[model samples]
Target: MRPNKRDELVSKALNVFYRSGFHATGMDTLVKETGISKTSIYKHFRTKDDLIIAVLRLRDENFRSWLFSRMAALSDAPAGQLLAMFTALGEWFGKPEFAGCMFIKASAEFQNRAHPVYQQSTEHKQMLLEHFTGLAKAAGASDPAGLARQLLTLKEGAIVLAAMSVTPDPAGDARYTARMLLQPYLAGG
Candidate 1:
């Protein structure tokens, strides 16, 4: 089935926001990039924040789907699947269109905790944390929550370093660190 005008708009806006930041890309830019008039955009979204939330929801769905599927494909066991996250990150970082973490950018642009955009960004991270926690439990980690938070931190750091070009192989470095972190949980450390 074809996407409706609102979905199409959100998709287009997501691209624009990914390329340009949330605050930098104004309504005019959105209209120009999305090729949808302000009147029509407002018809679907009461405000730009509402549109951003919609875009974030789409991103959350797409990103989590891709990451989890890649993890599962890369490793059958839960322990390996946790490490596979870095492999998946390497693939994503290598993409020509890679522009760092959208949720990170969103949170930076929308710093106020009360802001819906910021809350949405927080929600994205929370979901990832929950997934990591579940995987840690499945992997038989002694401290599932601790391991999950550590992995999430490593993942986020790798993303930041990659985006900033701070390291030539942040993903490789992160994967190595992740291996060490997962050592005790593995069958034979």
Candidate 2:
């Protein structure tokens, strides 16, 4: 198979995984969706677990790059950048196909703490926290680490509410809450 074929398969698999979920999706389903032979699929990914890891890694890299680019375009003021992050998240959650956070969805599929996917999900959250921490420090927060942690909690809570509730504006509501939380920090800055 061509190199592009491998990429195409992964991309298709990601969409399937995101929509139907990992445990619900099978290799046969992926093969049928991608119009690729099972043999071709195996040639690229030896096992279902391997494919899942690759898809998750791709997701993490894409999210990190997209976030960094968005953050880079904001004001040097960390508070502003932090607010922008929440705004971006709101917009994302409001999308028509937004079923909830990919990592969060995947984490729910596994109850086992030792699962590799669980570790990957945890790493994704940690990366977001680290990014927020850096932004908080740059914005001149008195306690960047604390502010970052708080923002993460706010974001996670919003995601959970959006996923579980019938409200259409979970992301917007969450951003509003985050702004309220950050007001004191911004005033100090």
Candidate 3:
């Protein structure tokens, strides 16, 4: 089914924001790329910030759904699913359209934590941490919170290094680290 005008605008704006940047992609660019007039854009989104929030919401929903579903499909064991998260990320990084993470990009552009965009990024990360924590607990980790923190670090680093390097395999490296860190929990240690 075809998306409504607002949804279509948000989708196009997300791609533009991902390719250029939240701050770099101007209203005029969105108008031109979406083939919708500035008036129409304002009708849907009162301001550019509103549009960005919409784009981020769309990205968050789509990304989480994809990542979690992929992780579930990859492994039946809780611990295996934990490690498979990095595998999923590796495949994502390998995609032709791969750019760094959208939340990371948003954080970089919107440094002020008080800002709505940065807060949205933080919320996205917290959700990831919660997911990791749940997996760690289910896998019988002694310290689920700590394990989640360590894994999140590995994931974030992999994302950054993969985006920065010319021929990156940061995901593989991160998964190896994650495997090592998750070892004790798997062994009932």
Best by TM-score: 1
Score candidate 2 by TM-score against the native: 0.90
Clashing pairs in 2: none
The predicted structure with the larger TM-score, 2 or 3, is 3
Local distance difference test, candidate 3: 0.90
TM-scores for the candidates: 0.96, 0.90, 0.94
Worst 10 residues of 3 by lDDT: 180-189
Q: Is candidate 1 or candidate 3 better by lDDT?
A: 1
Q: Sort the predicted structures by lDDT, highest score first.
A: 1, 3, 2
Across 56-126, the per-residue lDDT of candidate 2 in tens digits comes to: 98899987788767766764567877877777777667777767788998788975789988889999999
Winner of 1 and 3 under TM-score = 1
Q: Model 1 over residues 49-145: C-alpha lDDT tens digits?
A: 9999999999999999999999999988888999999999999999999999999999998899999889988899999999999999999999999
* Ordered list by TM-score, greatest first: 1, 3, 2
Model 2 global lDDT (CA atoms, 0 to 1): 0.81
Q: Residues 49-118, candidate 3, lDDT per residue (tens digit)?
A: 9989999999999998899899999987788888999999989998988889999999899999899999
